[model samples]
Target: MSKSLNTLFAALLLSSAGNVLAASSVDLTVKGLITPSACEPTLSNGGVVDIGKISAKDLNADQETHLPSQYLQLGVTCDAATLMALEATDNREGSNFADDMAHFGLGLTNDSEKLGGMELRIVDPIADGVSPWIIGLQNGSSTWIRSYYFARDNILSVANTGGAIPIPVQQFTSSLRINPIIAPTSGLTLNNEVAIDGSVTLTVIYL
Candidate 1:
């Protein structure tokens, strides 16, 4: 039986070699572009937004408490004029009380309840010392829109005045505003001191 099976396999191989075979092998390619220009992104105040200690009595019990907005200086410097975009990602995912992707989580309580959320907005963008409009592109989308809200996993770029296309820039600066909102205390267990543990990472993507 083994000999018969081997003979059948040999006959099939010979027939395959004689006929036009269907994809006996495929070509694999790894393609990418390496540019000479490099960009560095930086945030003032070490990218830390301190909400400070809050009194339990000062918190709202029935509705969400909106804290005062804070502003941070965001700057990006490139070795040469390059087209790039800034991407934001939530380091502490799935902890925000809100259901919106633009809201970043402030961590959870000891009882595992979502603490709160924070929103980031990019405003007053200046590219190469000229005021320019800021545009954002969401993941898996090709369209770019004029937006101020910096959503998670979104790409933000700068465009010239009256232009919708993103342009190459060497220096970019903007004011990043943070609006923090705390969930009502009625649903949270606050027997112990809870820290505001929200962290987000800003990355530079070369276009």
Candidate 2:
């Protein structure tokens, strides 16, 4: 199941089966856990990747244009050694050219045309001064796999080389490489300057 930092509130109704017709009330219970240790995640350069001005005539007319890849450092620090995970949420959703989870939207043009897409990859993760294997649990899967690419609404964690579960760590750092692709210019509205607007939020989750 997918994990989240939000407190889970579940209400359990209790009633006697024999008194199904006579019972007038039932007991309700709500349960959740709150951890003491908190984690803070930060990105270098204020998490901004500024791709300078691009000329419309310089873009490909019939094919996608792959821009130069950019790298950003992501750091996560915890008050104590805590089991945690990172989740990425795209602020510009539904604007990508593809429907794949690995692709993040770059925003739209003319209010209807998709601008393009971008892919985020996590590389060389170091946890507590030790290099650990980056792991991610696939949606609907119970097992964790060795993967560094960020997926939509997926939790990314770190573990030992042979471990299957996330390990506790007070500090974690990694490089987030961004690969951006622009759609064909022939189909885009280039009459005015179209900024490449892509925003994603990285959240830390206590596991």
Model 1: runs farther than 4 Å from truth? 1-25
Cα-based lDDT for every prediction: 0.90, 0.88
Estimate the overall C-alpha local distance difference test score of candidate 2: 0.88
- Candidate 2's error at 56, in angstroms? 1.9
Instruction: Give the runs in model 2 whose Cα sits over 4 Å from its true position.
Output: 1-20, 24-29
**Could you tell me how far off, in angstroms, the CA of residue 62 lies in candidate 1 after the best superposition?**
2.1
Q: Deviation in angstroms for 3 in model 1?
A: 31
Candidate 2: residue pairs that collide: none
lDDT of candidate 1 over 1-207, digit per residue (tens) = 999999999998887885785666789999999999999999999999898999878999999999899999999999999999998888879888986888999999899888999999987889998999888898898888887787875888988887768899999999999998899999999999998898989899998
The positional error of residue 151 in candidate 2, measured at the CA in angstroms, is: 1.3
List the candidates' TM-scores in order. 0.86, 0.84
Local accuracy of candidate 2 as per-residue lDDT tens digits, 5-82:
222322122334344564467899998889999999999999999999989888898999999999999999999999
Task: Give me the candidate number with maximum lDDT.
Answer: 1
